[model samples]
Target: MPTTQHSPQGHGHAHSLAQGHALDRSEAKDSTENGGEAGNMPNLSTLSLDELKQLDRDPEFFDDFIEEMSVVQHLNEELDSMMNQVENISRENESKGSHLVELKRRLSDDYTALKTLGEKCDQLNKKYLKKSEEYAPQHMRELLQIAASNADADCDRHVEHFLNGKIDVQTFLNTYQSSKKISAERKAKEERLGTQLSALERAGI
Candidate 1:
């Protein structure tokens, strides 16, 4: 459809003029000095859409009129949150370090105590072993000597009976030689064993 352009003549758009108080907005904006310049509808036709949007960002124009308290409060809250997080991290790090140090100290003390205890136990065992070594051979020798004395007493009775002449001389001589020879042989064997045993002891075997 073609636009029927209104004219500035007596009767171009009587309907546009006919809208009553709405058109009287110009009259309302009129002050005593300047004509209705302030009341005029903004002629957005002069600016591109992007340029009009940039107008709100102009600090010189908006800073004097806009309320900025909310922006300041938001920034303050963010800074406070960041500071709290940093403080928490520092505290955690300090606690962890202290705990690790304490654990290390405890471990060191435990190790030291265990080492000393082990040394004492080893020394005690060595002392007992030395006592056992010193006592064992002497005890064995005394036991053997006691057994030898008992055997010697039993032989003395038989030798005395033969020496009293109640038995024949030939018989007594034969029995006595045989018995004394056997005893001598046994004593010599025992002496050989004792020498070997002493050698082994001296060699720490």
Candidate 2:
């Protein structure tokens, strides 16, 4: 029996041919799956050693392959440029989202502060209005009028006491004169305040 020996170069050549055949079969299957239309062809860089070797023997195929490789290279560069733009847009959108969130937080804080301030203002206004009412000119006039009326009533009671022989003449006169002065003064003050309040109302103060 005789044994056959294979050279390294022959083995490599056979392997390359096998790879080319497999690639062709794959392209044929892809085309069939795509309704028998030729799909995207593989890049020249992915060509088998056997296919590359054909460049030396076929000048027309070589030129066409070179042109196709150039188109593929241009398309790859454009795709890379587009991908970079997409990445930049994504980063910008993320930054904008963060900024918008911060703005919303600040707005909420401002609204809370404004609400607190408004509540405080309302409290102060109510307090001021209560104080104003207590010390109002019309209220003071009413108090004075009440005091004047009480003085007149006391004088009338003292007169009755004198007439009933419950008080001396001098004591009754002294009390009567003092009560009259007080009543007159209070009446005068009440009239003055009333006049001032009327003027204020007329002027829309």
Candidate 3:
């Protein structure tokens, strides 16, 4: 079976995008709750060293900062779990997709084989029919008649044996019935084949 390549890069990129979107939502909510305008959102990296030191020394500011960091940490852990789930799902999809592709390929091959077999069957049938027309009509009629005659003789023999106590009732019925069935079928076939023979004779074939 052919193998499918599933690069980790694509899966990682997708998960990263999802994590970024989640963080963005969290940041937006934090900004709204703080009653701060988007433009006033401070970039810690842009702050002067003295300004950062001043904020770090403020107890109230530090408490709020720690609280916010805790929320961000929790969100990161949740995002990590989401990323793992997405990775598993991606792997499962790849496995299932590969199996599906193989199944389709096998089905296609089987269908092609069956189509070829069907065509050959049709060709053989046409050839057989042609040969049957060339030589078999009279032979088939004679065979059917002979089969009917033999079946009738077998049926009469079975009945005679039953009457003479050579066979029990059950054995006699089973044998006689089977012979009669064969006789009936052969007689019917002979009649039908006789019609075909007559047609062939009239057509001078």
Candidate 4:
């Protein structure tokens, strides 16, 4: 009889008929005694003596049985390997999915904060622009008041010269009227700027 020995490369086609078993009893016994292999395989202890005798009478039948058992064992090993791979893939997917969800949540929060900050910036810009616009006309009016005072002083000097007979009445009238005309033009420009400023303020600019 051939010795009952397991090999990593599996059995050859030519197996000893005297050592052939109906079920993988030797392998099962090794498992029970030594915890040699994993999973459930066929055990010859489950077969009747009469069945064993019948299998012993036919070497072909025993050989076929051994072949079938080898095939089943190989298939079980492959199935276990596939199951392990599937489990690993599932764990990796779960971890990645959790990380992706966290990233999406952070991105959403960042977008919301950015939008709020942008709105605040827009509000500040508008406030600064409106104040600048309002101040511009006020500054122009102050400069115009200074210019008008200077012009009035100049006209008063010309009138004094005319009264002292240092200049004629025609020259005096011309100089004074010219100054008044310049003052009128300045007032009209100031009124126009004031109207524009009021319109801008009303429009919330």
Each model's number of backbone clashes? 0, 0, 0, 0
How do the residues 93-153 of candidate 2 rate in per-residue lDDT, one tens digit apiece?
9999999999999999999999999999999999999989878888889989999999999
Q: Which is the leading candidate under lDDT?
A: 2
lDDT of 3 by residue, 86-118 (tens): 999999999999999999999999999999999
What candidate 3 gets wrong by more than 4 Å, as runs, is 1-68, 138-205
The candidate with the higher TM-score, 2 or 4, is: 2
Candidate 1 lDDT tens digits, 25-83: 66665643343443333444666766567656777644432333355456678999999
Q: Tell me how far candidate 4 lies from the true structure as C-alpha RMSD in angstroms.
A: 18.8
Error of 1 at 65 (Å): 11
List runs of model 1 lying over 4 Å from the truth. Answer: 1-68, 137-205
| N/CA/C clash count, model 1 | 0
TM-score for each of the candidates: 0.38, 0.43, 0.38, 0.40
Query: What order do candidates take by lDDT, descending?
Result: 2, 3, 4, 1
CA RMSD per model (angstroms): 17.0, 17.1, 27.6, 18.8
Worst 10 residues of 3 by lDDT: 35-44
Q: Model 1 clash pairs?
A: none
Q: How does each model score on lDDT?
A: 0.68, 0.89, 0.84, 0.78
